[model samples]
Target: MSQTSHFTKVNRRDLLSAGAALIGAAATGLAFEPKASAEKPSTGATHTEPSATAPNYAPPIVQIQGGQLRGYRDGKTTVFLGIPYATAERFELPKPVPPWQGIKSAQSWGPVCPIPPMAHVGIDEFVFPHRYWVEDEHCQILNIWTQSTSASAKKPVMVWLHGGGFTNGSAMEAYAYDGKNLSEFGDVVVVSLNHRLNILGTLDLSAYGPEYAQSRYTGTADILAALQWVQANIAQFGGDPGSVTLFGQSGGGSKAARMLHTPSAKGLFHKVVTQSGGGEVLADQDPAALLKIQQQIAAQTLANLNLTGSDISKLKTIPYLDLITAGQAALRSVAQANNQRAGWNVIADDNYILRQFCDWSSDIPQMSGSVFSEMSSNYVKSIDKNSWTPQQVNEHLTAEFGDKKDAIAAAFKTSFPRKQVQDVLFFARPNTRALAAKAQAGHASVYNYLFVYEYPVNGGTTSFHTAEIAFVFHNLTEPQVRVATGDASEGYALQDKVSRAWINFAYTGNPSQPGLDWKPFSDADPQTMVFDTVSECRNIHAKELIALLPPPPAPRF
Candidate 1:
């Protein structure tokens, strides 16, 4: 079973050209500053124009931690961007980024971290609209938004991590990820960040050199470092450090789950929300089997490039383009050999990554759920050009489930009789139940949901994996969605109800919104909020579905 070659499967040069076009749109004008020299709150400050650079952008300059900070007022909310938390070295583990001089304008969003674009392959569920552009090592930064008109309204903080499968994506992708809506709508301060990824972030080489020893989990370490920075500096931006909530969708949820058990992130956050995401708990193979492939790739890269010394500095000096080319080649080789899962996955490195990620936070309260047809429906959209037959769907089921193929296929056939074979093959029979089951096992005050508000596509494509993101961010009419779904406001009312529920959940442990009251999951009923054209809470997946899905293993961390 060879790994799919997403790299060479597409034309690299053409993809890079498309990538360059995306980078042009990535630049945004927002900013933030450290809060060293704090300023007292002025309740009724007039909105006056500052200098030429900040004509329409007028925010009170607050001093905290020996640094002056400025925030811009947009409508009823104040927004900030590009706040530096930690400074990372070129291809080095993240360290404390030094404080800057004077008032640093956090008015514009910073550059995104680097990754190659999978352009040849058409868009799928996870491919966001942002450019897959690469940037410098100084890419570690955060964005902030607050609804407090005064500088003294200490609001609860919601820290977000953008999902790109630990490879590509940033905090500045869509306006939906922006803090303005969350801050104003929920009356809470929102913060998002961009961190290292792919080979630059997750190439384990500890078995080779001491320099590589401390660099095993560089990507996760970068996230932990970012959280630590928030703890030290969020209070300056009118955020409560003691009441920070960490949440994300898809890859972001996976990162959040990893942080839940990470020793370094013990007290950094108090609440967790994982939507349509799970950690690396699949019980197929051991992590060490994949790690060996990464070490071999690194060794081959050094030897082929003729770098004898073990110092990473020499490796760092290599040109960016060359590194990308070599990394792609390494990935292709791994895929062809079917060594393990593709390159740069989180490995269980004894210290940082204790065990396969499982839901073991029974002691603490947690909220978890996924879209009803997350991976299943997304697969249908991915292979729209080709049609699949029932035999084809059954064959795929055999491949994916091995000994349990017949039961899984039968379940999908019985559950969705009229669905296309592609839908049955991809979305109708995925591991969505496993995600909810894993979380429920931990006794964490867990809640679940099935986002069923189908985005009305022309033919019969329903709401897919990422359909709720734009709505949750209060950007139902965003440029991206408008382009995809012609009828933009079809799900507007549903969006309003669901987004508010998410914000309310972030504030209190419950998803108790103004008009909607969602019950938390329990042993007797396992309450789930099904967000359709009209929202309601109930166990949509019947007892048969639950019985078909096996129970998840308890977390070992």
Candidate 2:
């Protein structure tokens, strides 16, 4: 079946014109309404409304394993915010949240996990506004959005994990992370959550004692706890525990990939969609190598605290922030000696955490892809859009790609005949190729896509990292998304198309929609769905280009 049958062919001229108009609209801060035909799906099951017994003004209430909780209504969706899923101490495994008293209010977002502030600012701050809430150790919370509060509704659930490596990021960091629109539009339950990060989550202290055996994977444990909560309580929120789908972008994507190998996470989620971050196999470390690093960190921190002992129990008594400072210092010292970045992260402990690589052989279906230009354009200096010339583009590409500059540029132009010179310089396919190869190796169905829709922000930025998020969430109307995507009618149309593909994948493990017949990826025929103004499937799009470039480094945890 031809995927192009449902899409109207979009020529280069139309795309450029629309992009220019989009940039103009963004400059003037204007909004555009989606066409009536593109507003909502006509064939999918309709989302259920609030129960007749629920009163307006008063929030809807639901009973869970712990106690009764109140949640608010935002238009057609019911939102339950900041529900505690688990609790844990510093460097310890997560435990289920204790039951609370009657009628607890889940009105506001919970505290975000502690991390360093964003020092290097970029357009990302505007695109994904950082939400500043209370920060503490007791921040293992989850949020839910559903169209129906009835236990019998049985809608498919999408659990979102935020991206920031293993260090920093919150469930509510990005406006695109909002679940209301996605819940209402897809008639499915949407979930997002917060868990421990950095040293608090992944400090390897197993050599100290068996109590800390799983401490290196506390963040993942927290996620497992959250899924367990969903399995036990999500029925009341209109979600199907049996049909949960795990989806995430960037670091979150890596986590989702890792979860596939986790023994405890086996039946928790049946499907996975990893966006731009889950392609590589996590390298295993020698037990002694990790122990050496941890021991170095411990020595420095202990001396800084004016204490002397191998006993790690004393660390629990130090002030949280103070311990973090000491840990950072120790990490830097060890990293300098090892000549690598200093930070705590997941390790293949070989006992409690055994999944060293994503098991594509499992029955869990997978869909993974990267943006067209992942972080390639972020290095470009701030210059007037009109001032950018072909010479400048060539110079930048030559500097970045060296001898392969000409070949890379030619391949990009051949692939995208209508793209601007600046856009061509930022064309990247290594990550996409890597992910496709990994997915193809898996036994279960694997679908791949290249998000080719460029958002005309500050004149134009190709499909950069994180740009496909708003579209997946069906949140093109948000101000930040508007700034990046412009008020183009085509943008909204694409949102409906892409978001529906995701919703469809969650529903049936197939991303095929009304007009698009997405095919599974394989080594012999590397079919990849290119999502643009007019989406289509293209086979082996990056084969030649990837061959010319150096192979990417192995996937790291």
Largest lDDT belongs to which candidate? 2
Give the C-alpha miss distance for residue 468 in model 2, angstroms.
1.3
Candidate 2 per-residue C-alpha lDDT over 254-372 given as tens digits, one digit per residue, 9 for 90 to 100: 88877876777877898999998876554434756766776676677677777665656788767667777777777887887877655666655555555353453367888888788
**lDDT (C-alpha) at residue 183 in model 2:** 93
Q: Can you list the residue pairs that collide in candidate 2? A: none
Cα error of candidate 2 at position 90, Å: 1.9
Error of 1 at 488 (Å): 4.9
lDDT value for candidate 1?
0.65
Worst ten in a row by lDDT for model 2: 377-386
What would the TM-score be for candidate 1 when compared with the true structure? 0.76
Question: Could you estimate the TM-score for every candidate?
Answer: 0.76, 0.83
Model 1, position 299: C-alpha lDDT score: 62
lDDT of 1 by residue, 1-557 (tens): 00121235666589897676566545543233334668754788776756766534456565555376676767777667777767766455787765668897777777677775455743553333444433655678888887653436667889988877777678876545766776777888888998877767776556556777756577778888888987877777778887888888888887887776576677788778777775345333366766677776666566556665455467666765566567767766666676344665665554576553333444445667776576556435444413446677667656656786666556655644434434433443223443454455565467777676555554445556666676677665666655554454657777778778777777776777766778777646667776776677765544555466445434331
How much lDDT does candidate 2 score?
0.78
Q: lDDT per model, in order?
A: 0.65, 0.78
Residue 99, model 1: lDDT of: 60
* Model 1 ranges with Cα > 4 A deviation: 1-57, 121-128, 131-134, 149-152, 282-287, 303-312, 356-360, 375-426, 430-443, 483-490, 522-526, 542-557
